[model samples]
Target: MNAGHPIPGPASVLAGARVMPVLTIPSATMAAPLAEALVAGGARCAEVTFRTPDAEQALEAMAAHGGLTVGAGTVLTPGQVERAVAAGARFVVSPGFDEQVVSRCAELGIPVIPGVATATELMRALRAGLDTVKLFPAEPLGGLSTLRALAAPFPGTRFIPTGGIRAAHLAAYLADPSVLAVGGTWLATPAHLERGDYEEIRRLTAEAVARSTS
Candidate 1:
């Protein structure tokens, strides 16, 4: 949240991108190439999750690559929010809604997308002035049917469904007008990164992008 570098709004950040690849980098060294592969394959945004020790460094590398709009995901605390912003994260995403984390992001002037699985959580997010939220574990939550149900009560709200989402599910999810973008790990799995299979990553990304837009 550097004042000099303005952060885009959540909707703007996700504009035109139908899929946002969720990445878990095992090593920082692979960050640049991974980002390159995704961008080359037509991705406009990505999320680097904080589930690994190399997350911060990897985020820095991806942000510096100057292609995809990079965000920090799996953030659990305000302290992690600060660290993520310092590492050049343009946006922040958490698995669940946390007032403290959202407040901290607000203080830093960065867009935060917190996960919500129920109307209660969705209400809380809307009350806090956030209309865009992540629908965590979307598949287990009943996928598109559940999303339609949740969106029914809040027409103005938008969703970015994540967790257990795959390429096969992309078209169906994106078909819903309420869905802003779909996030998934299949585009850049840990195994893909471990094997340095950037080509496969690029192919998957391209395929998903094509399917989403088509």
Candidate 2:
């Protein structure tokens, strides 16, 4: 596999703080406005989930937004990976780590942050040469306690816990030195998106960022 491309430095810079707002929009057309709201709210990046029908288009819109560091989320296949990169995603994320997807991303040189839930999955990711990965459905998988436990043995690995995460867990997750960032849909809830309440989204994002940094 060819190292396709270098992971943008901004990704590491932003993740170092441990706050990445994940967005699952209804359509790709909503991507730009939503991204603007997130950035205004203080988040410099977003993970556009493939759950929506317009995932690829959304990724393109967010990437074109300029200031926001956009990534493709919920990625499950190598085809999606290829399309995502072509659509302008800066990185790739999956609910679980798939060797084919991971290796494909590795070859493409795109920084892939796959999901993990147990020691087994974590170890698999480690063997694949990944130092950063996501902890899916973060809360149900033991949340902070689980992360604390994993940290001791895999001190070199960093996690971005997502799934069932709320603002309440923000501090605990970010406080952990090994946590690269936490992903959740809290910042872009359905009600907020339906109303196109960019201001409110922006405010919440800023608050989340401030709280994390504090």
Candidate 3:
């Protein structure tokens, strides 16, 4: 499936936001607490990935918190999209684009941000009607330089660069008018979650938001 087509909700809910937190949590129980930390710390959006076994439950937990714009990430299949939707995911994101997944999400009116790595893949996504995409492994894929190259051709597109992204790159990515936001897993690492150090998470969230808007 391709990207350009609109997903029929509030893209602004995710777009241009200062911080878009990406997390791979281990259990459903941590979702609320972590989400609370993020919001309290100033982040109002997140992408909860399915890398862990309890992803669906975690999504449910986070959704129940209210006020957060939560998206399901690492979504690789139609089945996963179904589960994520059932768990109340408002949007779906993947490391790469899959025609079947994109089609399914569209059918259900769910927004999808599929990954693209090159000019060819970016065009492929655009052909499939996707205007918003995720640039995975951002730094390895050429980081800010690659984004600049992409903008020349896909002038109307918006991106959310994930993977290998750091706090230092926040301003560079967010400064671009074509960039919607960025995703990274460092904010909610296992060690911090294990210790339930929500205060630190809140601090980091504030710092990330500040950097993105700076």
Candidate 4:
């Protein structure tokens, strides 16, 4: 992750966040309060996934809320990259690394953590000048051991593992130095957002943070 640029790298975007909440908003209304609650829990960063129609508006609200390192997730297209930045996203993430999407983001100067599942995809990321990446659906992809094996080859790279990760599973990932951070949808689930359970979300976030830091 390069640092001397105007936009921060994945390292900076992910810094101080042991577990980043992967959020999907049902509407624009839930953005601010959700960000505030996560901030209260000591995690200042959140990934607002572009999975719903209201995602862009929600990202706009969250980024404008201030104090949060707001990132756009599930971004799959170059056009979405444009929209994400337009909506105030400080960083962008994709399920898989695409040359077009990455190049577009580079043109815009926004840091992107593209998803890679194999050595082949990782080589592409390296060629694209990316030092950090996301290991999507990590649990299904063999979890910690798999990452360890992958890291053995690309020692300079850092990984953020996402998908199907539970609170009980945070320690194993964080214990590895190659893991920059863990991104989990379990931090603030659809149920929590739908029910407006900021308290539970905060509590869960706090618990995860406490454990990750300890």
Best by TM-score: 1
> Which ten contiguous residues of candidate 4 have the minimum total lDDT?
1-10
Cα lDDT listed for each candidate = 0.91, 0.83, 0.84, 0.88
* Residue range with the least summed lDDT across 10 consecutive positions in model 2: 1-10
lDDT of 3 by residue, 20-100 (tens): 788888888899899899998778788899999998899999988996888899999999999999998888998997888
- Candidate 1 vs candidate 4: the lDDT winner is 1
Best by lDDT: 1
Off by over 4 Å in 2: 1-17
Model 2, 1-214: lDDT tens digits are: 2244333322463555457888888877678888888878778778888888888898899889887888899999999999999999888999997988988787777889999888899998887777888988889988899888877888778888998999888998888888878897888876788888888888889889898879
Better of 1 and 4 by TM-score: 1
Cα deviation in Å at residue 100, candidate 1? 0.6
- The full ranking of all candidates by lDDT, starting with the best, is 1, 4, 3, 2
Give a tens-digit lDDT track for model 1, residues 1-214.
2234333358776667879999999999999999999999999999999999999999999999999899999999999999999999989999998888887888888999999999999998777768799999899999999999999999988899998998889999998999999999999999999999999999999999999989
True lDDT of residue 80, candidate 2: 92
lDDT of 2 at 137: 82
Give the Cα RMSD of candidate 4: 2.5
lDDT of 4 by residue, 130-186 (tens): 889999889999988888988999988989999888998899999999988899888
Task: Please identify model 3 stretches exceeding 4 Å from their true place.
Answer: 1-6
TM-score of candidate 4 versus the correct structure, residues matched by position: 0.94
